[model samples]
Target: MLGAIIGDIVGSRFEFNNHRSKAFDLFTDNCRITDDTIMTLAVASAIMEAEEQLESAAEIGDNNREYYRLVEVLAVKTMQNLGRSYPNYGYGDRFAQWLSSDQPKPYNSFGNGAAMRISPAGFAAKTETEARILSEVITRVSHNHPEGLKGAEATVMAIYMARNGADKQAIRDRINGYFYTLDFTIDGIRDTYRFNETCQETVPQAITAFLESTSFEDAIRTAISVGGDSDTLAAITGAIAEAYYGIPENIKEKALTYLDTNLQAIYEAWQEFKKKRSMNITFRPAKLQEREILFREGYREWPKNRTFEEYCSDNAKEDEYGIRYIMAIDDEILSSVILLELKSIMGKKVYGIGSVLTPQNHTGKGYATTLLRKCLQQIENNDPLIFLYSDINPAFYQRLSFRILPLEFQKVKKSTCMVRCRDENWEALLKSSVALIPDYF
Candidate 1:
């Protein structure tokens, strides 16, 4: 959601001027939020309202048909309400007309607006099927054209897969199989691409921009460099990029400033709504029946030339050190981490977190992050120090307030060692402690 807003603001100045190069400054005074941001927020608002209403309806009776019907109705109402509030936000001719119509109906449009505003559905949905259902419900209120529906569904699915930890190849393959045949590259088409507003022309290029990008900023730059419906292109690309590579804190902070009071409130409310939803997630030690699945998954990370039974036996031995903590909903394990107790150093209790893994099917739902946060809350007050050897990007743990320890404090050969301290004098504590490296998990 913020990703789309950031892209919309950054690309607003270039939408008409067409700066077909990546060397331009990202944010400027001329940059402004447009229809993209408005509709994105509107869609998000409608979804939240619909979900709240659905919960209420579920308490009374089972009415899936009526619940979805309400979603479509609220989508139209919210978009019109917000669109009318921002009358001069550069909405397209047909969309502007639809907004003003008291009895607005689908205009059979296949515009890029459908794809640009569809990202919130991806984030709100729990499964690919729900993602498609949400996309179709919200989009059909305005962009009922088949191509428009396809474009929106494709974008939503890309976000769903990216958030779920699908690799680039998997996303590309799925898009190719169902949505668009991404045979062209950003570099191949940059010189020839022109201003276009249709979804068929816009979505594939935006997706390619994200595919070729190495960072969130790079995705925005690459989308603008294509020189076609710049804001919409970048908004589409930015949504996917944010799902894959989180927006840096600096970028997210700057982007929020562009929103006015009402929009800012909506964004804040959405954050709170999401947080409340995640509160239902529970974390605990892995159950006896679940250890085998954990072992099988862990073996993929560290096979050690051992048979399945040998790997299970070896993992069982680690129970003396620590137990596996799992994040789950109902009976499904979403993510797991090994919590190891290490020998106390300098009279401070030390704990090691390792084998942080989310099953491939559940990568992007933020289960691991929630699990880690729960783990920290469970231990931080009781222990003075906590440590982890990160096998993946250290930035992930950094976001959780872990600092990379100096090389002298590292015990492993190639892994990055990081620590979280409950005390303010942890640096001095580290420097004064004896040269005793703790055992690696």
Candidate 2:
């Protein structure tokens, strides 16, 4: 959704005055938030509210139908409220009227607004079917036309696939197979494209702009360069690009300045909402009943000479600095790791992570990765330096932003040592000074 806002602000000035080339400044004084941004945020606000309401309803009984109904009502109310508050921001004639109407209803329109504002659905949904359902529920309050619903669903599907690790070709194939044919390319239509507001004309071009781009910035430029409904086109493109490439920190910081205080609060709340929703797995200290199970699992790593009873007895001994952490789902342990508070080195606190393991059945399901990520988030503060030694490929830890140390700096010979520092200065200090390898791990 931040991607959608960035595209809207960058493309706002170009919507009227078309810049046919990609070489141009991304942000300028002339740029401003438009209806595309307002509507996108409105949809996001609706999703957050709807989810909260659904949770309350779920506590009572089954709320499948109630969830969809809440989204529909909240989307209408939120869009109308925000739209009226920012009436000067470029809304279409019918939509503007709907915003101020005493009793608003779907106008059966096929406007590109549907696609531009529907990116939140893609990010919130857990499955392809849920994506379509969310898109329809949020869209039909105004864009009840078949083409409008189709445009929104296509955009949501692209974002869903991108965020879930689908490659560009796979996303393109899915969009092409289910929604749009996507027969035309951005280069082929750049010179001939004209200002248009219909979903049929806009969604395909926006998606093509994303498909051909190499990065998030390039995607925004590509969409604006095509010369038609620039803000809406780029908003659609940017949403997918964000899901695929992720936004750079610099770009994200600059984009937030365009939003007002109210909108900024909404954006911050959405960030927190997403974090809470994504980390659904429980992370806690292992229970007494699970200790024997974990001990048996840990014994597999060093079964050469130690018997099961010996290993269990050794592990049961209490250590002052060591604590066992586990990731579980409904009382079933999925992954486990031991965290050690090592002695500080050069006045800097150091932590060690070891014995990371996931059951064979849960190996490929990302349980271990989730556990490690949660652990990092919980302990990255307090000016601590975290280290891990991986007997497997170092690339897996690298993806979590852990930097691999040199051979001479490794805690153990032939073992890949990785460090997650608090910042650049901490990393520089670690690199320049002696390596602090914990004796326990």
Number of backbone-clashing residue pairs for each candidate, in the order shown: 2, 0
**Candidate 1 TM-score over all chains jointly:** 0.68
lDDT per residue as tens, model 1, 1-441: 788888899999999889888999998899899999999999989878987876752221122557567778999999999999999999999999999999999999999999999999888776555688888989998899999999999999899877765546557867887899999998899889999999999999999999999999999999999997999999999999998898999999999999999999989988887786666567789998999898888898878689988988878877778988998877788999888888776787888888898998777655676577667656665545778888768988764657788777777776888877744546655776435555666
Model 1 CA deviation exceeding 4 Å by range: 56-63, 280-326, 329-441
Worst 10 residues of 1 by lDDT: 56-65
Candidate 2 lDDT over 194-224, as tens digits, reads 9999998999999899999999999999999
In terms of lDDT, the best-performing candidate is 1
RMSD of each predicted structure = 12.6, 11.6
For all predicted structures, in order, the TM-scores are: 0.68, 0.66
> lDDT for every model?
0.84, 0.83
State the lDDT at 138 in candidate 2.
94
lDDT of 1 at 235: 97
